[model samples]
Target: MKSLFLFFFLAVSAAIYAQSASTAIKPKPSYCNEPPEAYDSRKNASAVKPAALPKFNSKPVMEYRVQVAILRKTDPTKYPFHRSLVARYQPCEEVWIVESKQSFRNRQDAEKLRAELAKMGYGGAYITTLVGYE
Candidate 1:
C-alpha cells in the first residue's frame, strides 16, 4: 500500500534526524563553570596600596552668575555686553547655555541682571553658580 510505504519513509526520516541531532557536539562555556575566587570580591582587592593624590585644600573662593538662556546657538548682537560684564557661552550636552556676566558675587546683582535680561526679550533667564572651577 502507498500509505504504508509513506509511513515507513517518514519513520525512517525521523529516526535519522533524531540520531543526527543527538550526535551533534555541544561546546561547554567556561563562564558557566566559574572558580571559587570569582564569588569573593574582597579577596580579589588590589594587592598594592594606591599612591596619595596631591592636596587642593587652598582652593579659591567661588562666585555666582546670571544664566540668561540656553539655546543651540546665541546671538551676540541682541545680548550685547561690555568686557566688564561676563556673557559666557557654554556649549555642553548638544546645547548652548548663555551665562550673564560672572560679575554677580551677590544675589542682588544676579536679580538685577536677570530683570534686565528679561526686558531684553530673554524672559526665562535666572541666576546660578558657576558650572565648574575657573
Candidate 2:
C-alpha cells in the first residue's frame, strides 16, 4: 500500500511540472501561414505624391541702388539730418533714402547682405528694397 501511494504522488507532481514548463514556453506564429493580402504595395504608393513648385509673378523686374545709414533717432528731428546726409552723399538716380528702426549700414546694400546681417546679430535692421522708376 505504501509503495502505491508513493508512485501516485510522483506521477501527479510530474504532470503539474510539465504543464508549468509548457505554459512558460510561448509558441511564435509562422510567417508562411500569414495571408498574401497583408503585404500590399498599393497602400504605400497612395501615401506619397510629387511636390509642386510655387507660382510667382512674371512682372518686369526693376533693380534699385541702395545706401545704408545709421541714424541717431527716429523722430523728424533725425529726418533732416538723414536727408541732409543723403543729399550730400546723393546715391545715383535710382537710389532712395529708406528709414529703419535699426541700424545696419552694410546690410541695407542688398537683399543677400540683409539676410546675412539678420543671421548675424543685426536681426532688428529694417529692410528696404529700392526699385528705380526712372
Tens-digit per-residue lDDT, 28-78, candidate 1:
456546655532355656876555557765645456687765654334546
Q: Which residue ranges in model 2 land beyond 4 Å of their true spot?
A: 1-61, 64-70, 73-109
* Model 2 backbone overlap count: 0
Q: Which residue pairs clash in candidate 2?
A: none
Pick out the ten consecutive residues of candidate 2 with the lowest summed lDDT. Answer: 84-93
lDDT of each: 0.62, 0.45
lDDT (tens digit, per residue) of candidate 2 on 19-124:
7775442233454455565333445556566355565656543443233444222222334432212322112222234433233334334555555545654455
Reference-based lDDT, residue 11, model 1: 100
